[model samples]
Target: MSLAVVTLKKGEGRLLKSGGMWIFDNEIASVMGSFVNGDIVLVHDFDGYPLGRGFINTNSKIVVRLLSRDENTMIDEEFFEKRVWDAWEYRKKVTDTSSCRVIFGEADFIPGFVVDKFSDVLVVQSLALGIDRYKEMLVELLKKVLAEDGIQIRGVYERSDVKVRKQEGMEPYKGFIGEEFSTLVEIVENGVKYQVDVKDGQKTGFFLDQKYNRLAIQKLCKNARVLDCFTHTGSFALNAGYAGAKEVTGVDASQLAVDQATANAALNGLSDTVKFICEDVFDLLPALEEKGEKYDVVILDPPAFTKSRSSIKNAVKGYREINLRAMKLVKDGGFLATCSCSHFMDYELFTQTIGQAAKNVHKRLRQVEYRTQAPDHPILWSADESYYLKFYIFQVCSDR
Candidate 1:
């Protein structure tokens, strides 16, 4: 039995008993026997009974992130294959999706790791030291998992560019494991098609998490002039154009994304009414207001301003500022579809932020709908920490 010593409170063992993974430093009763970072440890309650075993990182606030309970389940090639295969099997049943989260740590019973499948290609992110150490088996398991599913081998691209890699002591790694392709990927979302950039695009090439929200905004854009702000790939604009929007404009800071959006617009033959602007979204709003520009529908889906605990307050301010400026450009009785991708800031904080912005502008706001990540990113009930992305569809009201 992989044994060291870490202590938990009297009743605190309950969560661990229920297969919970996290063990905060403060929750520890004490540590006995020296355990280096990422070494396996045997956890116990006050009574000194074996609770479970998992990897321990004394340096992290999360002192321990449990990997497995049973000692017999060796942390070897077979161990990774079992978990990877299980995650793959679950996704196949749940998703009719072309792009999906093949592994959602903890929810899929494997913490500190995640894998997203974009058609035949796989993107793996190792978020924990325990799982990060198992990279060899993990990759091997992926290959075997693909073989089992009969997906022809392409290559596994490791997009470990996320800041989470810092905790795992891993450097940023991205690129194709095998032959890379020059062309973009073709994926369908809610009957609308998109070409996703596998290598350089954001968050595993596209915000697949926001797949449903884009479609919801699409339904409201019919016969209306739509403005999609911070529009990476012009998803909202393109969807609106496809759903019968009169005209659509997508604004972003990146010329690359603007060009990608333009190419995407051409793909669907909607370039006639669709326009892409490579300019700052913040700057464009006031200029649009000055030019007496207005849109029947507005979408404000910006990149997350807050990525850590310290930046949450600033992120809220940024959210409010953007929403306030955006609300001013919306036509009376027009809809504003906004979203927050920062999981550190909860929905309550975001809603209140937007609510205050609306009040300051003296605009009546009615929430038309709420949206979250598509079904592929399932929330584990035992641990409700899974919910991250939130979208709000609101209608602004003036004298009209």
Candidate 2:
């Protein structure tokens, strides 16, 4: 069967040529042959040089998401199995496979689809129509690949209920992919146990991307007072407790999150040392400052302040405000761990914002270390969107 061909305009396809998988609508010069949206299509340069094969969708600005650099490559079960196998092998080499992100969208060379494993359960999120069609096959392949390593998957759940699906001309969906099982799954990370609510919890239950980051805080928390803001499910706070912190306080705005976090603390036998509070971090930080309360370690793991470029100014202000407040609450020579998970807020911008916050608060920050998301979520260079997380640890000291 002949495949539809899409030709890119001259001087366009720069990103695609530079190892990125996306080919935007504006980059196309012309199209030949008939093809339906979400169908595999051939991509070519303006002069008719064959580029590769990708799934095309006119509904999205990202018109084409390349699947392979070889135009003649078959898009079948065998093809997908290889993708799944490679992703799993990479994870085994770099991260603990007990529970981690199995596929990280474009970074894993499978764009607009994400699969995160929580113990024996797998949560799949398909954001683009092209990948949505193959979600079932990918899940099955993942199960097969995992079974090769003696890991049996208990169930599969779909969490494609994101607004991004609407942009792809597909309705958001959520539910079991196969047999229904308990949505609550327990998983341990860095000696901390968490009950992940795959059905109602945040994206794919818990934030596995911060697995190592949570572990990184343990050494700093021993016998120290620790404050964890935006403490989702007490991951960081519990890690601090397990590290034998004298006292730990985790703050979040959602009562549900606070409840879950509290439960996790008890699950890990850290309830006595780590306590979760249902309050806005922004509001609580200033109140804590007024009470002359200071901590030996302060952790700020706030959600992305902005998802788009337009809202970046507001995001900067939000990051600056919280960081300035957190810095002030850090006792002299105390450690501060802060991070931003927004891809739009690049590393340079986030670092500059932290610098600005320190200056405004009259604090001297001695850099300790810098980090990003865990290796399971590999950052594909030149694919800017694939890299989002930026983490920094600094020692906060009073000015002379």
Evaluated with lDDT, which candidate comes out highest? 2
Worst 10 residues of 2 by lDDT: 128-137
Candidates in order, TM-scores: namely 0.90, 0.99
Query: Which segments of model 1 are wrong by more than 4 Å?
Result: 9-20, 33-36, 69-73, 76-79, 178-183, 381-385
Scored by CA lDDT, what does every candidate get? 0.81, 0.94
Q: How does candidate 1 fare on TM-score?
A: 0.90
CA-RMSD of model 2: 0.7
User: How high is the lDDT of residue 233 in model 2?
Assistant: 91
Candidate 1 lDDT over 162-273, as tens digits, reads 8766655656677665566553668777777778787788877877777778878877888999999999998888989999999999999999999999999998899999
Candidate 2 per-residue C-alpha lDDT over 229-340 given as tens digits, one digit per residue, 9 for 90 to 100: 9998999999999999999999999999999999999999888999999998989999999999999999999999999999999999999999999999999999999999
For candidate 1, the lDDT comes to 0.81
